[model samples]
Target: MPAFKQTQRVHDDAFDPSDSASAHLYISFGAHRIRMGVLDAQRNKFVALEDYEVERPSTVENAISFLQTQSVSNPLLQERKWQQVRIGVKNQQFTLIPEALFDLNAREEYLRLNAVVEPEHEMVHHHEHPRLELINVFTLPAALHEWSVPQFKNSPVEFVHQTSALMEGMLHMAERSARPHLFIYVDKNYVTLVVLQGLKLEFCNSFFFTSSEDFIYYVLFVLQEKKMNPDQDAVTVWGELLLDSELHEILRTYIRHVQFGKKPTGVGFSYRFDALFNHRNFDLYSLHFCD
Candidate 1:
């Protein structure tokens, strides 16, 4: 059994749990961590962000059981009157299919092409990107899905893969750009890369890396394979890396215009969130745009 440690938490003084009816809750579940964000819908502002880290669960069953225990003691998770609840699953168990080729009845079959799926233990889910004309088919622990629905009885609980969130956020950022832009999201031991030409997605995938060398290798590989000029194209980064970190330094050494991304626009943020870096939770905040 493992315990979850709170790594970060920030909220405006005006935040109130009783007002959950007017707020949207976003939760992102990763290999060994959970990140949550609360948006005050009425004010169009984000009021809270919390992060928790736990030892990687041995199985999906274990992960769900661990969350079940934590939810009971968490005031925000207990609230059932949220305006909306969005859950972002962060894993490699997903595949994106063009809307025209997607078969509603073959979600499991489509995902199996990229990853092994145990239908008996997991439930398949899909999120459609009308703007992208793509459908993302993924899975979650069957027990987890069953448990989450009741918790949001009065609100809709929508599930999506983290990459879907990234696509939505990146498209929003690339709206006015005429050139292809590269975006990278780094997590504990994985990095998700997305290449966009304005609003159109050109490439997207995730790679696992254990060291700095491996990280740089995958990044440079992608740039070269995509025929992108390292000296000309711009790269925007988000998630766990820092401005002064070794990863950022290595990236700048090779790529000409490497910069950290800002939080998604069109939504306000409380001053309390200023303490966090602007790019910290791009995926969580992007859930607001996931329809």
Candidate 2:
């Protein structure tokens, strides 16, 4: 491949440019209904290519088959033949996807619910949507829902939380490279802890990444492997947490845009969350979080 060609792809060229995403099928195992759409950028809506239900599948294979073999006539099959598929589950979410069954990683994506909390979460938690720069988040209304999350009756919150984060991660990932990526995080308890770019999130990632250091190391590795800079023209992040002097004094160095859990930046947007990570003692720039 040529170098300039790669650069051209990263920075889209158009009159009105924004990230584009599509779903051959948007099945929420949690919610049986699914939305198949071409992912329109101007509509600011799913434009649902197809609307229906899959009743949720119990295993990864069954779910993929449901999506792949799902009647070719279904309006949801936008690509006709998807080179990949992404599955997002939430709360009591369940079922795995391509990554779970494959030895090769880049071919699929498995986005669990709420995996989008950190960057998208904080960014939206900071700047309102339909307005934020570069990165963004959007609800696929009339698209997908957790009618019945695929999960064991008494699974664990950790698993569920990581799954949610993974889902968010998948949305962000798909929105980024138009492909899947691996996910690992801690929403409450279950921590896949190892996030791999390109391959979509999935059930049972065989790798384990503990500690922020372990996580950052791999990210840096990806940067080097993909040849990106930590600073300019690559991914940037800001984070938040509940205000606690002791915790602040201990981990503040790690947090990006933290404040107390009282006032949040966007009270008018569709999102909901207390900005409990700010402090009266914060410097001027950080004070913006309180508004």
Best by TM-score: 1
Candidate 1 lDDT score at position 115: 91
Clashes of 2: 38
lDDT of the structure predicted as candidate 1: 0.87
Per-model TM against the reference: 0.95, 0.25
lDDT score of model 2? 0.28
Let me know the TM-score candidate 1 reaches against the reference structure. Answer: 0.95
lDDT of 2 at 1: 12
CA lDDT of each candidate? 0.87, 0.28
Off by over 4 Å in 1: 55-59
The residue-by-residue lDDT of candidate 1 on 1-291, one tens digit each, is 576779899989999988999999999976587888999999999999999887555455556776788679888888888998999998888899999999999988899899999878878999999998999899886787887888788898989999999999888777557777789999878899999887888889988888988999999988988889999998999999988888989999999999899999989999998999998899999988899
